[model samples]
Target: MPHLIPDTGPQRVITASNFVYTISSGLYLTAGVLYFTQAVHLPAAQVGIGLGIAGFVSLVMGMAVGHLADRHGARGVYAITLVVRALATACFLLVDSFWPFVLAVCAATGAQAAGVAARSPLIRHYGGDRPQEFRAHLRAVTNIGVSLGALLAGWAVQVGTRTAYQLLVVGIAIACAASAAVLVLLPAVMPGPVVDGPRWVALRDRPYLLITALDGIMAIQFKVLTVAVPLWLVEAITAPHWLISGAMLVNTLIVIAFQVRASRTIDSPAAGAGAYRRSGLAFLVSCSLLSLTAGMPPWAAATLLMVAVVIHTIGEMWHSAAGFEVSFALAPQHATGQYLGVFGLGAGLAEALGPSLLISLCITWGRPGWYVVGALFTVTGLIAPLAVRRAEYRQRFRPTHIEALGKAPVA
Candidate 1:
């Protein structure tokens, strides 16, 4: 019988790493805020400020870390960052004061950023011609791991003791350490042919940057799910509060079931652009349906919200697949790390700014805000194809050595 998963050693290693890291992240996601406020005894505002500062610092350092991966090696840098992340997470156990907590958070955030910066380059190196599929598999496994971790975290929340929080932190640290060990066992990915250019070449690539910005805008789907929808359901709509958790469950299930299949068609720029267009349409439908839920009977609103979430989840799968395709397709082979780092800025920006933007527009402004978000998706999706085309055109004029990296396979 054929292997159910990828049979290659590197693919297995990478998938395991994703699973372990996401489990660690999941353990923290539901517990971090509580640990800070209840266990560390930090004020809510201080905790938020510390986390915000850490996120900003990580964002700023992402590109430099990517450059480091390029100069050194993606695998080596990735492994080292994982170890650093583990150490930082362990330090959280010692944080009794606000300043100590802030420092630990920053260290963990920076290490995570560096690890993420190296991930795509490592994938590109090992995944051969099918990096998107490999990435999709990793995502699927990550979802499964996170689901398990979240369940475990729920148990910790139920206990809500200092010992529980400490155990969660220790588990995360151990998971990170295990992931680093797994990463070390993978085959080394030799750097691509060096391109002669300034260290910040990605910063000057205007077309690529535009594509990254559009990708970021589409990525607000995450914020929509976690922040906007929960508030909208509880405050704006008369729907059941259970719908929020239901929606998340739907999303996770759909991603696990369909993400890899959706990614199969996204091997080229045009295909990636098409996926973006489909995602935009889905987002528009979901948002439009969601807006109508206000003032409806609870049953009707709940049904509508579920439908909208299904559509939104479909869009999410496509958007993620397209992201992998476009990022890999447009990046010069020699500068993969830098390009991925720059591309990462869109996600960082979305996470940082999406909550405020969505809340201010969708929640505060009511129906008008949802409309704005839908329009934003439509406009960005329409522009993505054009941006990819322009980037491809630019690639045509690059040095012969750069072009030799070969184009993504035509689907």
Candidate 2:
């Protein structure tokens, strides 16, 4: 079958942007695996707290860094964030104790978050009127990088924990530095409008706030499953580590295969809303299946978990791609960076709250606890359809067609 990827246009900027995003994905993937394994070793009570601290810091500071990117230029901000990230990734190698690991993760998280906030809006600079497709392609490239890094790290773990940790740190540092170099090579792309006073007021826009709120709620399923499900597989069901790893590998691979296709298919406002709504429904079903894990035999529970993970992963691809497209369309030509920064805040809060809430529920209510979490997702998904119907949403949103891009207002 033939493929239907979007045109990336003639700018070297798009190519450079993709390369930069690739480095971020690769670095984060390697570092994150190590972080997760190490975090899991700590006392269960402390895990949620540690993740919360890192998330909250990233949420607040990411916006500030992004604000800088909006005022200056994304390329300039990218240059700074990459160097900081490289240094922070290297620090992970030196973290021996729990407290140090916690602190290191926080710094590393902030750097990654800042890089993302800067890069997202930067796409608008390169993409002209086709930011949605451009951003989708960037995300697809990032996913490819993530798969490579995860595979490398997965093998590294088998060799020895310390060896894997050292290799990841060194490799990620190299990637980060290279990304900075790529940013250096790109031409300056200017922000459309220069705000006279404090630009934080840009966040007060009602429509933008509503979309982010919806996004935050959608984040719960992914965060909760990745963190809480693995522990459940091991402690509650006593499944093998290999099974957990396999499930994740499957999830990543499936996403890589279908994500871009799904993105292309659902590039319309109604389609995007439908995907979110369906994803919520899927989450409800997955959680219901997961709840059954408490009642099933070990082998059966592992199988059920795998099934749930697959369904959840598909929904994830739809939700992520659609959300990216919608957010890009909604951003004003002049305030792209500021808008993306605020969007990042919604994601940050979700990352902070989702896992912590799931972990607490799991600790308190045991296996079936996630069902309650699932219900919350179901309720929140309801907002997406409403968002699609609103006139403000339609103003920035459109059907999946070349005509839509041409209609995008250029500064």
Candidate 3:
């Protein structure tokens, strides 16, 4: 037993979370393409509807599942959810009909919801009382997992698309199972002494809600990069497939390296808000860079796209960390999971709506679409700082300056 186990620290948490997310990444990489290919056998409208239904279900039910984790505890919930997710992945091998695909996606989405809900709250619970640092660390770990997943998926795709899908299902099942087994052996949730009264009261805080809304908007950038950018690369610019893949890989690798370090500079809500403001500015600049891509040759466009992605990726990491920190700091003792779930809602909505909106803009505006997206991002990003300022003024409470917040506690 001693030889089998390693030290429990930041590395341990990162490893565990990375394992879970890596599996998730592998599953998602193939699931969408596989479902669509299978869609070729069905009506195109049905395929779209089926995927939409799965996403909607995940968006709605994810909060409920997260709430349950808050009330019930994370360990048992994680174990059970992973088991279910694994079983659902296995069932995908038999999904021949449209209805079956729809149902399978719903199951997988639910599993994803439950799994993330459990994992994030657990990180917060263990990170003493400073939720922001904990949340940032968790995000860093997950991003690292995502990078690893992309690499593995790239290899899987090269083997053969069908073979990749089959292996993805199998790998996802095994990974989920392994994570559940390991998570069960960890310590119980340590959210500190339960203070008396309602944790739901955290929802009423003005700054917290505003921050979450900003988080939702910032999340759209990710939606653009993954869904919108790829389509533009192929259809609009007619760029080579390798350019698209390489750019994404570059973005992922950079994120994994810098997220934690960059996030460390943010300390208080006000400082976070400042970071958010900077993020907004960076986004606008990135969008401007993207707009230039439309006017360039294919190779030149790919280079510009790569540069824009790098800038956008930076803004994403900053805002993501700041958003999590804000949620963790403002959440009441007993309701960390609940408030976090509400924070998670912003992300869920972005995932649901952002892709379609970006894609639509791309299709409708053509070369001009990049500018439209740039304008939207610039406006939204600018709004975040103003909202932060409004929250500061309306509350009549000056946030604690980062100078006095003390050093961040180690994991």
Candidate 4:
């Protein structure tokens, strides 16, 4: 279990920060939209629009902030982003109209994305010899934190009052602030010497960009459980409605139990590609299983849905482990934060677009649509190995990895 919980002070500090940060995220995840509609009393359409704007804004902020970290320093920048998120969360209390709501959400989402990219350098600096595996440990800690935070937010949801909702929002703000404060316990991570290349070198890497694009398509699977399954269960199937929570619980528990174990094997970019391919086929099978649950009776539907979720959860683990491997392995150490920021674009796009895509493909079009979505995943997975190979060829030629092999860099 040391793999699950690393024994070093630095690792523990990072884990603690991630735990608190993700707990705040969990608080917001469950009640964020509801708080605006229920407590602030904004219309649902406005809320949706505001969130959409926030999502797109976040995509650019991460890259910018990450580059900032590469030039200045990571530890302080990461702390600042968390504090910004905290302040933005506090602004939720002041939101009264569409513009105010939009302003708050955009800042909050932007900081959250920025913090993730900014933390990459810190993770690499402190994550021992293998940052990828440490990242896996953080992921497991994240699930535990999110689950606890969700459970805490459940009380507020159950209360169903404006005061209670406001309290939850305030608590989230506190959690974020506390998370930042926790980071001060860790040592500072100074920026590496600025390389004499283009400012946005990561963006210029065409092969890596290809890998990012494919990963983005594969990232849509994230919404399958959170968005698609609940909607499908309610609208299309006869399964008990409680299965929504059941499915989430199942997925969360699986990640908590096995994410570290899963990452143990994906130690390189090529291994990550293989994991992606396996996950794609698993997702296809899971999607197919979920489709079959559509016309079954309640007991049968429930059984099939449960099985689908477990299969999907397994694939999710593989997908995540693969991401950790490739994203960190391929990044230049000097530009780790900035490269990770670029890497995040794929997942950010998936977050922004995945819900709509899943709704249109899986929920709106019915069973046949599941196969289409599954095929897309499988195809993306199958193609990833090639993408990684291209990226590998590209990276080997780059001065970073080449110079590491005791050879003089090529120009």
Root-mean-square deviation of Cα positions for candidate 3 versus the true structure, in angstroms: 5.2
Candidate 2 TM-score versus the reference: 0.82
Q: After superposition, how far is residue 118 of candidate 4 from its true place, in Å?
A: 0.1
Candidates' C-alpha lDDT: 0.85, 0.69, 0.66, 0.90
User: Candidate 2, overall lDDT?
Assistant: 0.69
Clash count, one per candidate = 0, 0, 0, 0
Which residue pairs does candidate 1 place in steric collision?
none
| Candidate 2 structure quality by residue, lDDT tens digits, 242-263 | 7777877888677767776777
* Candidate 1 structure quality by residue, lDDT tens digits, 269-307: 889999999899899999999999998999999999999
How many angstroms is residue 117 displaced in model 3 relative to the true structure, after the best TM-score fit?
2.3
Q: Best lDDT goes to which candidate?
A: 4
Off by over 4 Å in 4: 1-3, 400-411
Give the per-residue Cα lDDT of candidate 1 at 201: 86
Instruction: Please provide TM-scores, in order, for all candidate models, with all chains considered together.
Output: 0.96, 0.82, 0.84, 0.97
Model 3 earns a TM-score of 0.84
Per-residue lDDT tens digits for candidate 4, residues 1-411, read 355677789788889889888888888898889999998899999999999999999999888999888768888899999999999999999999999999999999999999999999888878777889999999999988898889988998999899999999999999999999998898787667756768999999888888888888999999999999999999999999998999999999899989998999999999999999999999999999999998899999999999999999999999999999999888887788888999999999999999999999898898999999999999999999999999999888888542353211111
Go through the candidates in order and give the C-alpha RMSD of each one to the true structure: 3.0, 5.0, 5.2, 3.0
What digit string (tens of lDDT, one per residue) describes model 3 on residues 180-236?
Answer: 777655666633333445555445666667767778877888876778778877776
